[model samples]
Target: MGRRAIVLLVALILAGLAAWAVWNFLDGVRSEAEAEQVQVTVYRAAEPIAEGAEGGILLSGQELIVESTEEQVDLPDDAITTQEELNSVLTGRVAAGPISANAILTRSQWTEVTIDVTPLAELIPSGKQAITIGMDNIGGVNGFVEAGDRVNLIVTLDIAADVIPADFPTLPDQETGGEGATGEAETITVTYTRYVLQGLPVLAVGRNVRLDEDAPTVIDVEPDPTTDPGIEGEPTEEETGNETVFTLEVTPEEAERLAFAFENGSMWMTLVPEDFVEVETSGVIIDTLFGGNLLDDIFQN
Candidate 1:
């Protein structure tokens, strides 16, 4: 070998060794930093953790908040990370079994319970079908219809001379008594509104359950100013909800009849007293608007 070639080979070996040593040193420093133990906050009982206590109950500011051991910890995946996370997902979840004081909390210690998830089907009793009817301000009693309340169902139907039912009666319009025998025969359309189903129980309004018995009567209430009207979803029933539909419990036959009336005509409901009392009356017709003794009701007052 040439003298210069041997020197170059020796230089190359030394440089390679130095580079490998520097890389190894950096890797060791990184591992040491990572291996350094980290302190994680966990909820530890200041006193004996009794059975049935909340798994994620908030600690008083002075409570003995705890940190993970100085020794490296292999915490279970279910270990709660923050007080806020514990409060939100674990609050009110009672301890399924007892836990010892100063012991780290685990998901297994608490019972999983679901809140505010009652389904509409559960509200309907056996042998009855739930029928939902759509309504607006006029038909829905201005958002007064609530679950467990009784309502009187009324139907307003248009009867054309061509398809009028034989059983259904019609009355003449007083104002437009019609060209009795005029050259151009005027077809008089009659509108009859019948109070069909009395004291039907309301099962639900939108997604809300029944109101408390002591809940105050609802009048026409303006939307809460604090409630962001811009925000949208199902509104909180009675709190912020503008209810647009109501479900009623009815027999199969009654449901079929109600569905027919809903498809054919406009249906309305009047909320009756909790003690639903039926009123005696035949259905109202065009004549009843003014032709009946109803005129006396207006004149008398």
Candidate 2:
């Protein structure tokens, strides 16, 4: 009886020890599996998203269940993940995508492109700046007259007047004296009796106006050229002077007009300010010939 009882008791003790060992091993395995299942975050567009969304857009995050594909997985509705949160789950590493939502979405074609105000410097104009309009002293160039540079604006008007020469110059008073008076004068006087279509003061003149240099320039925006200056009238050997940079302070509406003028007319810029108000606008095709003194002959004669 003693031997049988002792053997049975020993067997029972060994059985209990073995069961405990199995339980401990199982517990460790479960713990390690749980730990291996890392919590990761991934971003999902608020709307259904396609791959290649355009760069720089907002995105929302969703939490995900991830592990070695061995343990029980749980992806709950409330799982929280950010670009950083889901990097490991989505891209196989933590912090893979940009930290910001916009940056992460920038590469995606689906993302909308955003244009910042900083890049549109040329299309906009500054306030309270003086811009040159009409025939400019800058050799007839208009837009180059920047916001601060002193510029004289010359406008042409059609007025019937008595042409007088300096020798028999129509004195300001005498030119208006009689009708049908025809004389060659350096100065011509428009009679008040004449009906002027546009009126007497054809030019609105401004001097020494300050330019808002910070104003955006709207002209032909070309990359810096590597060539030397080309000869006038001959057109450049390679790249001719195609674009004219007109720097001026003008209202948005006026800017439209200036742009139109640059496209249509022969414009020039002159550094010198002239007081030749009585100059004739007609017969002065001097601008077309590209700097010839032909008009000088007409004036001299």
Candidate 3:
């Protein structure tokens, strides 16, 4: 009786222990699976995102702690604002400055450098030439042209006005002197005049032009082609003109018009004051349009 009882009690106790062990293992696994993951909530505006926008998303960058003040950014109407959208915005690269207000972020936003390809114009076959703020061989300084000035280009055709001499008849030398010979007659040919037409305003000032020997003469500069450079940061304005000698800052659309005008007609940089109102349509034709001509045209028109 004692041996049977003792063996039965030992077996029961071992079985109970085994069940408890199994229960504990299962409980541990469930707890691990339910554990919280490292996460942060990034704030994003409520707007759709562009396919390849200038900015969005913030990874490891200048951290901006959440404050009482509401963070803001400028966003287009169709910008995106969602975790998945944010991921896509940042897929190519992240830019500095507030992600567009319409952009969405998983956690927070980071700003990287931004790059903009603006439109500009340069002389063809001339390479890049610095825009000098001076005058030429005229009464006006640099033709009175400045960095932010505008003017019409008029070309003078002839150095001097055309003139013609008339022929004369010789009177009877026999009546006056008898043996004397008659005088001969002579005449001169007339000369003609012409002028070059003026082109529309196509050029804009891109920063003040300065003298630089390292830069090449501006032979050709149109508008920036790439809508999005896909780079994370924007180069400084000076950097944009690294290879450019004359960098004319203008709108993309305006760039097209300027390029067309430059190619179609004769374009000379004429300098006019900001408050200038008089516009000359007809005047003396010259290689460059001067202030005198502009004033004359305004009155004539």
Candidate 4:
């Protein structure tokens, strides 16, 4: 080999050794990565676990704590490492069984709760959706409708028969009668209302049942003449026969229609008697209000 060849060969051998050293160093660091200590919070029982209380209730800092442990430590499956995981999840969940004092809480110890599921989710029928609608005093059954009551929803629309421009560009022609379509353009406004949805179970009324707890909340929805529920005997101007919001259970398809109706027009609620059964009726409209008795007296029924 020439001298130049020998120099090149030596340089190549050094570069190979340098590359091997770097590779070996990284391999060693990777091997120790899991063995490195990390600070994490783990649950510890402070007292005897309640029969049905949430697992998180036992997780005060005094009871649970953050400690340094190897990343590869043998953690129980129920181990909670973060506050959000604990609060958002484990906090409201009931224990599946009793937990002994000083026992570490693990994922396996408590019943799992679906995230964002309401406490009253059990009441919602499958294939249905829960939606809220805004209502004034009259639309809310005058504060008589409770959360579990059934109601019918109606919408009132003011349609105006207006003379709009033709679909395509056009101009008035005096030579051809000089009159707008169907005489001079004018709007004939009409007030009409119709039932939109029926047999809807009231899921919530006003702000009282927002939490979806099993029992009706202590927050009184209606005014009482003799009690403090009416805001110090005489209700405040705002609280007397004030507006209430209602949440109802509806089929997914009906939810879309109801949402569209709510946005497009005003809604009224009609409370239905629990004992009364409803037969299918082609909902009432202004055109049918007189039926066959168009000329009958108003009070003749």
Q: Which of the numbered candidates is closest to the native, going by highest lDDT? A: 1
RMSD of each: 16.9, 15.6, 16.7, 24.0
The lDDT-based order of candidates, best leading, equals 1, 4, 3, 2
Q: For residues 1-301, what per-residue lDDT tens digits would candidate 3 score against the true structure?
A: 6999999999999999999999999999978765633223344433333333334333222332121222233333333444466556555453323344434443233333344333233221133222221113242223233333444443323233333323334444765764433344444332222223222232333344432334555432222212234334676543543221223434455455555544544344444555656554544333224535555677799
Sort by TM-score, best first: 1, 4, 3, 2
- The true-versus-predicted C-alpha distance at residue 70 of model 1, in Å, is 10
lDDT of 1 by residue, 61-146 (tens): 23534655423266666776676766655565766655666777666777665454446676677999898889887788888777
lDDT of 4 by residue, 1-301 (tens): 9999999999999999999999999999987884575646665565566545554444432433233332426676557666667665566666666677676666677775444545556767788878988887777777777777898888777778876545433466679956445434567776667777888888877644444555444422232232122234655644554547788989988899898888878898888898756555654445556665443545565
Off by over 4 Å in 1: 1-111, 115-126, 162-187, 209-238, 291-301
Candidate 1 accuracy as TM-score: 0.48
TM-score of each: 0.48, 0.26, 0.27, 0.40
Clashes of 3: 34
Q: lDDT (0-100) at residue 215 of candidate 2? A: 48
lDDT of 1 at 92: 57
User: In model 1, where is the ten-residue run with the lowest total lDDT?
Assistant: 219-228
lDDT of each: 0.69, 0.37, 0.40, 0.66
Stretch of 10 with least lDDT, candidate 3: 63-72
What is candidate 2's lDDT per residue for 1-301, written digit by digit as tens? 6999999999999999999999999999999988878654433333333232212222212222222221124544433344454332333112222233222221222212232333323433444233444453345343343333333223233334665454563335565665443455454533111111111111123332232346465332221121112222454422432223333545556546545545544444443333423333333333334346656756878
Greater lDDT among 2 and 3 belongs to 3
Off by over 4 Å in 2: 1-24, 31-40, 44-301
Total clashes, candidate 2?
Answer: 37
